[model samples]
Structures are given as structure tokens and as C-alpha cells.
Target: MADERLIAALDFHTMEDVQKLVAELGDSVSYYKVGMELFYSVGAPVVTWLRQQGKDVFLDLKLHDIPNTAAGGICSLMRLGATMLNVHASGGYTMMKTAVDRMHAEADKMGIKCPKLIAVTVLTSINQEDWEGLGQAIQIKSAVVRYAKLAKKAGLDGVVASAQEAALIREACGDDFLIVTPGIRPAGSDTNDQSRVVTPAEALSNGASHLVVGRPIYAADNPVLAAENIIKEMENVK
Candidate 1:
């Protein structure tokens, strides 16, 4: 069986690596995040391939540009058929709203189902020290919450945030707003570059709608088993 909430992050740079991993993971993962590295390497066809395999995609380009440029990018990417896509919440309200409106309008014109647009609140890899180093006055958790609220107000479907802030975002944005949490490490797994990592069960219990897992699954000796174990952990959340 596949777990839709468990989004495997395809961080590989080659199509061969992606194909091999997806084949190995099989039904344990029903969703995937095709981030900038993979997308830049393999291009839109990777998204097409994922859809062909009956898997949902979160196209993680994290578009951040001027209003018109970002909206144009969204309109273009929407044709790739990803289940979800996102912009940077820091792109501000008008940019986010313009992207959302244009995306919906483009989908309507094309007669295709619009991808659920989201916003990146803050990278999960940024911790307190890193945040403070950037000369940011507000705390990381507070900033994440503010971004989540701004995203919702801008008409986005939700946000890409750390599971650590899931409970807060849920409280502020309500139950329906999607909080796609990355930096998910299973118990005893290495955190790697993710600074705000959480266990699968903890993320779900903290109100994360989806969990994007990378190293714990893909970097494991047996990727399929790792993914299944994480899925089991997610299923056990209560």
C-alpha cells in the first residue's frame, strides 16, 4: 500500500538515479518532491515521468521573483501536472496572490485541474543561529508563523514549513491549510543538513499534513524498508 502523506524527496541529479529509487521504493511512497536540483538536471519530463508512475508530485522550485515573472513561471509550470507547487512567502502578498490568480486562470483556460499552490515559510535547514546570523530580528518560529499566515491571506493552499512549527501554523491557519513538512528523520536517523528535523510520528502529531523525507529513506542501505518503516511510523501517529 502507498502512503500519500509520505513525500519522498528525489534529491538525485540524474534520471537513472530517480528511476532506480522510485522503482525500489515502489508503493511505499505515493508522493514525491522534485526539487530544484532534480528539476534543473532532468527538467519537466521528470514530473511527467512521476505522473506516469501514478505518483503525486510536489514541484519544489520555491519560485521567488517579481510579481509578473513569478506568475508567468507558475503558469508555465502548471502544465507539468504536479499535484502541488510553491512560491516563497517572502515574495509578499501581491506576488503570491498574483501567482495564485494567474495559476487558477491558466488552469481554467487549459481545462485542467489546477495544482494546489503553496508557499515556503522558511527553509527547514535554518535554525536559530543561522537565522540570527542573517540579521533577522524576529525569532524563527514567529517568522514561520507570520509567513504561514501571510500565505493563507494571499490565497495560497498552504505552506512548506518545518514540523516544529506545524502546531503553530495549524493553530493560526486552521486545520484545512496544508503544512507540507520537510526535514523528517526517522528515530535515530542522521539529521544531515536539516537543522529542525523531526520524527515521522512527531511531525504528523504536530499537525503536519505531509512529510518530505530524503536521506532517511533514499540514503538508507535498503530504501524500500526505510520508507516502509517511516510509513509505519506515520500510520502509528495518534
Candidate 2:
């Protein structure tokens, strides 16, 4: 189902909030992104709990560190059985490559399937102005594409980018490479803190393999309907 492509983000601070949202959303959403806030708040059991519920988890820790440390962290998280894991693309090729290699080795050792490894190209919260303010010479889109290229070279399965840059990433990395786009606001939903937001249909049409939606789904009065509507929008594009 196209609904599987929609990843509901568990952005809550506690397990009670997470459980409530997940129960409310129910079968409309099969994939979930457990980002740092919820992850740090609840820890590894959250991933295990989501797994127990038969939902896929995208562990969005955005690991960024020295090659050995990053690799070690990924290897540790591997035991949690997350469906996907990501590192910062800015961590450099060696770091990304080392994480990928070690992740595979660990999976083989444990006789479990290795999670898809992706790199975070850029956070959707940063706009062109914010990027320039950080003294970045390259334009935001260009930098994102450059990072996507580097991520692919590092043997990553994909890069987390905005849908605005998804087509470019798809073109540069090819159709098979994953382009998981966050900052997805369905139609007229508030943009919230994210700077580069797109509607669910626009994101899928723009070549995003998956959409991570948080506020729009979790905050809606009827979360199940909200998620179903977004999934409908996603399917209609095909």
C-alpha cells in the first residue's frame, strides 16, 4: 500500500504520548520515524516496542562522529532491529563508509538483516538564509545534491533530504537510491519549525521515496483520518 511510504514521526517526549499516538493512528501507518527527542526520552525499548507492534522504525539519530565512533554507535543500534539508520552526510565519506561496512559485518555476525543505511544531507529546518549565515558558500540545493552524491559514493542506501531536492538527488543517485524526505506538510498544514515544507502529494511527485510527517498527523483532531488523507494523496499521484 502507498500508505506504507508515509512514516509517522513519533516526536513525543514520553512513552505514554508515543503509545497514545500510535494507537490512535493504528493500521493507517505502518512505518514510524523515532527521532532523537523521543529516542533520548525513552531509549531502545521504544524501538523494541514498535517492533513488537509490527511497525518499521527509522532510527533518526543522525549519527555524526569520528569513523570508529560512528561505526560503533551504528553497530550498537543495529541490535535494536530498526528498519533504517542514518548518519550525517557531512561526517565525510570515510565515516559513512565505515559505518556501512561495520553495520553489515555486525548484521552478518548476528545473522539478522542489516538496516538500510542512509545519510542526512541537510536538515529541512535550515533555509538558504540560514545556510548563508553559517558561511556556507554553496546554495542550499546545490549543497544538498553534493551531499547526496557523496552519500551514494559512501555505499549508503539513500540520503534524507527535502522533497525540493528529491528530483535532483534521484537524477544524481538514480531511481533505486532512497530519498526519504522530511518537512512534509499536507496541503494547508502549518509549516511549524521546518523551513522547506511540501504537501504530501508534492513530495511523492517530486520523487521522495518516503515522507516523514509529524505535526500534521499526530496533532490533528482525527489522526487516523489525517493519516489516511495523506496516504490517499500519496496514492493518487501514482
Candidate 3:
């Protein structure tokens, strides 16, 4: 199914809203990202509930802390059975490696599916000018490439980045390493807060293993139809 490549960004406030969307979209979208906002509000139960509903959950916590803390957090998050987990690539190789090693160890012991250990190279909302404001001389592409390498060295399965940088990441990290691209906007949709955005087709064609579409699908007038259309666009590229 086309939705296999589509991850619906469930940026809702309440679990009720999550349920409503799940019932509405049905299996057209199986992967749902429970990001920081919703995660903070609902917690691990939400991840459990999503799995109970037969959906794959991408726990987008973007954990970034000391290696020990991050590893502990990964172990806890793993118990919840998330399909994917992410940490900040900027957390350095040690932190990311710590998460990966701990996650694998815990998953093996628990005998459950080990979540894809991914890293966030850079948030899609960060643009060149915005980056410059941070007083960093590193170019956006340079930073993404650097982060991708760090993620690879850390033994991560992939990196979350903009599709605009998907090819660069793919070339650097190789084909097996996952590239889940967020900040995806269908043609003519509002850019919203994302400084870097691309259409579903463009993202898939550029080597994105999956697309995380939030506003474009969830915020649409007819969410199911919108999601279906986007999925069509995603499949046609292949």
C-alpha cells in the first residue's frame, strides 16, 4: 500500500483526537509519529494504544542528554514497543552510540522488536539564516552531512532530516540506513513553520525511506482523502 511509505504526523492534543484520526484515516496511514508535544501530554500509554490499534508508532522524542540518561530513556522507550526512536545527532557519537547499544541489549533481553535507532540531523524549521543566527559558521548541508556521519558512526539505523538533504544523507550513509523526512508539504500547501519542505513525490524520489506529513494531511479539510492523494503521489514516483 502507498501508505506504507507515509507516516501521518499525529500532532493532536488529546488521546480522543488521536482516536478520532485513527478511526478516520483507518489503515490508509499505518505509521503515526507521536512527537514531543503529544508525547508530553499522553506519555507511553499512547504508544501502547497505537500498537493496540495495529499501527506502527514512531516515538519522536529526540532524546539528547548524557549517555547514561539517554540510554536509560531508550530502554524505557523500548519497553513501550515503539517502531522507531530518535536522538539528537548533535548529542555526539557517544550519546547516540549509548542509546543504540542499550536499545539493542534491552530489545534482545525483552525479545521484542528493536526499534529503528535514528538521529535527528537538524530540524526542518531551521533555515540558513536561522542557522547563521546561532553564530555557527557551518553551512546547513555541511551540518547535515556531519550529523549523518556522526549517526552512522554511532551505529544508528538512520537519520531524520529534510528531503532536500535526503540525497546527501543517502550518499553519505548508504542505502540501508533509513532516512525519514519530515517537513513534507504537498504542492500549494502552506509552508507553516517548516523552513525546508518538499512534496511527497520529491521526497520519495530523493531517497527518503519514509515521509512524515503533519499539517498537510492532519490539518486538511478531508484528512482521509488528503492522505490518500498524498500516498498516490508517493507511489507514482516509484
Pairs with backbone N, CA or C atoms under 3 Å apart (clashes), candidate 3: none
TM-score of each: 0.98, 0.98, 0.98
Q: Report the number of backbone clashes for model 1.
A: 0
Q: Flag regions of model 2 displaced more than 4 Å.
A: none
Encode model 2's per-residue lDDT on 1-238: one tens digit a residue: 3377899999998999999988887788899999999999999999999999999999999999999999999999989999999999999999999999999998999899999999999899998889999999999999999999999998999999999999999999999999999999987788989999999889888899999999988899999989989988888887
Q: What is candidate 1's lDDT per residue for 21-136, written digit by digit as tens?
A: 99998888889999999999999999999999999999999999999999999999999999999999999999999999999999999999999999998898898998999999
RMSD of 1: 0.8
| Residue pairs in clash, model 1 | none
Report clashes for each candidate as comma-separated counts. 0, 0, 0
Over 4 Å off in model 3, which ranges?
none
Residue 208 accuracy (lDDT) in model 3: 95
Candidate 2's clash total is 0
